[model samples]
Structures are given as C-alpha cells and as structure tokens.
Target: MRIPANRMPTAAAYRPDSRDAGIRRYFGLVQFALIVGVPASRLCSWRHGTHIWVPSPDIQVGDHPGWSMACIDAWVPGGDPFLRPPVVQFADTAAIRARYHGMPASTLWACIGDGTIPRPVVWVDNRPGWLL
Candidate 1:
C-alpha cells in the first residue's frame, strides 16, 4: 500500500517506521537565574519576595523608590551540545551578568522581549500538581 506524503501519521505508524527511530533531536540546554532583592528603606522580609537591582558595587537600586524591579534571566546554551551545557542558578543581577558575560545585553534581552515562555516541568519543583 502507498501512503500519501501530506497526511499526518498516527502513533501506530511508529511501529513500522524504522527510519524515524535512529535520529533524535536535542533541544539543547536552557538556564534561568531568579533574582530577588529588597530596597534599603524597607526591611527585608523573607515572606515577601522582593529585590532591587544593584547597578554598581556601592550603588544599590533598592534604596531608590523609583527603581524597584525584580526579574529573572534565562540563558540558552550555545556551542557543542555534548560539552558546555546551559548553566542556570538563582543569583543577583550583577552575578548573572558576570557569569554569563554580557548575555543580558545580548541574548537575554532579546528573549524577554519575545514574551513569556512557559517554564519547563522539571523547574516546577513545588508546583501544585506535584504536591498532590
């Protein structure tokens, strides 16, 4: 029997599709940095997650009321997939910029502009579905 190329295959098609078995595609590594900070005027409360970006070693944005912003930076891994994978961690703005080395100004900002991408299930350690 001849199969038409335009039609989508059902899961049962995989039973005889040996050509599809050998090739696997890797999406590559993704990293996210969760930043939390507090303003100098407000007492740091562990219950309320808040943080301000520190622009410099001496200048903490937390003190400036006009400058309250909390954010996360995600990094996409580049280079050999087998080697250097994407590195993700919870860190301050400065540390993230340092570790990824200008990734914020480059790839990171572009991604943020693209809009919210869904968080992967592996990252949702405390999500409601898992708690049950």
Candidate 2:
C-alpha cells in the first residue's frame, strides 16, 4: 500500500531489509579495537603492519578497512595476540644467583645493598624474588 505524502516515514524510522535484526553483522574500526582491547590507532597501524608482519583486515569498504562480527570473534593481533601482558618468571635469590653464574651470597647481598642489583619484584612464602 502507498502511504499518503503527509504520512511519509522519516529517515530515522526507515529500516533497510538488507540488514538483519538478529545481531550486529559488522564491526566498525573503533568497535573492533574496543572488543580486541586496543586503541583504534593501533588497529589501523596493525592492519597496515608497523613491522614485518601485520594483520590484514577482514573486510574493506571503499578505502577503509572493517571486520565482520564473525571475523572479530576470531581476530588475533599481529604479535602474540593483543593486550596480552608478557609472562613474568619470578625466581628467588638462590635461583637468581644460579642465573648469574652462581654469584656468591655475600657478593649478591653487597650488590643489593649498593643498588647494583635491582629490588625484588615479588614475595612468596616470605621469600623475595626478582622477575626474570
């Protein structure tokens, strides 16, 4: 049925049949970055690759790159995934001394006192340890 000219629907009320209401079908650059836990600038840089390896965008609209919701779910950053902090390996004085070729306990203590050796990063079971 044809609507009268005076009853014409406004643009805001128009819904294109091509877009399904089931769920969001696509992710904008900003939205993808937010879900991936990175800044939009970083995403753009990664898409083009700031290093030897770069993640390619899943979809492109015009000159801008985008991703489908499905692709976003599977998205992995260029290096070791995005926003993943590096694992810190903690070792106590004895273990640390072993790493330094078994430096003497007295020498290690002197270094610690003289500020040559950095402070411990964590304490477990009342033992101090440095991050390796």
Candidate 3:
C-alpha cells in the first residue's frame, strides 16, 4: 500500500535496529544546509565547534557517513523557516522601487548589500526579495 505524503513516517522513525543494519536514514551536509537556510561552510563551522556535531549513522554513504535527520531535529527543532510565509511585510525590487517613488533597484540593492536597509528575509530566483 502506498502511504499518503502527509502521513508518511519521518526519517527518524526508520532508525536501524543494529549497528550493522542494512538500512539507514540520514541527511548529508548539503541536505542539512538547505534545510537550515545557512551555507554549507557555516554548517561545517558548526560541526567543527564543540556545540554541534552531526550524528553518525551506522550505514555509510560512500566513504563518508551522514547524520540522522531525527537527531538533527532533536538538536535543532523547528519547522523549515524558508518554507514559511514571510512574517513581516515584503516587496520585490520593483515593488520597493515603486513604493520609494522612482528609487532605482540598484540603489536599493546597494543599500541592502551595505546593511543600510534590512537584508532580505527571503530569496526569489537568486534575488533578494523581502523587506523588514
């Protein structure tokens, strides 16, 4: 039987029974980085620090092992922030320009780049697209 997407078990629920178990559920650094909204470099830094260490799984992927999503969830519990709708008012470059009455997009981007205006909370198609 096929399980519904929403009702499917989380990766943690499928933890292996033994150290030599053939099956494993884990998230690689890239996957974890995407989930956390930070760059992979930052995630690596966290791993290097004493506070965070990605959990090692019994089953390895290639030569490197990955962390169980369940453990990561326990370490940092929260829904994916990126998927959530913006909590504050936001506008795209065009909207922002219109709102500012002919302010150029380049100027707005420069301001955002230099931390003059708030940095974008969301990215759209590789472009900053939010206001705070």
Candidate 4:
C-alpha cells in the first residue's frame, strides 16, 4: 500500500544522492597529499610556493581548499610513467630493495645483463630504477 504524502518522510530525512548530509564530498588537501604520496607538511609547503605542487582546488569551503576527482586526474600526468614519482614514496633505499625480494644492486644489475629480468623503465633522480 502507498503512504500518503503527509505520512511520508521529508527530503531532508533522506540521504542525498551526491552529498554527505548537506556538505558535498570533496578531496581536500589531506586527501590530495595521500594521492600523490607526500607528507601533508610537504604539500602545505608546496601550496605556498611559486610552483604549487597541486592544481588549483575545484572548490573552497571556508578557509580550506578542496579538489574534485576530475581536477586531480587531469593534473596528475598520465603519460611517461618514468617521469612521475612512485605512488608510495619510500624513505630509504632499503625499503625499495625489499620490494625486489631483497636483491642487492649487483644481483639486480646481473639479472638485467643476463636477460633474466627487464631493464629499469623508471628513473628516480636520473638513476634508473627497476619495477617488477
């Protein structure tokens, strides 16, 4: 049976299709920082620098800026993977080495030489790095 209009819940009582309560969901600075794999402190510094690390925010709520998904996708380059930073930044070389089964530089270089593995396709600070 259908309920009468007067007996039905109001629009305000229902969850919005696009928004969380009254506020629209957006990727804020914290979210942007995580996406680019950088410390929020570092992002903050970039935000004020001449070459801002992030594109202009899609929206600004009060004092904070927020980015939309489209904005981020367009800002982050899609071409030349070697030129971009790793999605998860490593603090030291040890962490990166762990990814390749703890293989040392010499062994990795040998593998590339013997055709056991592929050569590095990505460059970190002009030094070619391997990914498998």
TM-score of each: 0.18, 0.36, 0.33, 0.37
| Total backbone collisions for each predicted model | 3, 0, 0, 0
Best candidate, TM-score = 4
In the order shown, the candidates' Cα RMSDs to the true structure are 21.3, 21.7, 17.5, 19.2
Where does candidate 3 clash, by residue pair?
none
For candidate 2, the 10 contiguous residues with the lowest summed lDDT are: 8-17
The lDDT per prediction is 0.26, 0.56, 0.52, 0.51
Error of 2 at 85 (Å): 30
Which number leads on lDDT?
2
| Candidate 3, poorest ten consecutive residues by summed lDDT | 77-86
lDDT of 3 by residue, 35-85 (tens): 555577877776667555543332333333355445455455233222222
Candidate 2 overall Cα lDDT vs. reference? Answer: 0.56
Clashing pairs in 1: 37-50, 37-51, 38-51
Q: Measured by C-alpha RMSD in angstroms, how accurate is candidate 2? A: 21.7
Candidate 3 wrong stretches, greater than 4 Å: 1-23, 51-59, 77-132
Which of 1 and 4 is ahead in lDDT?
Answer: 4
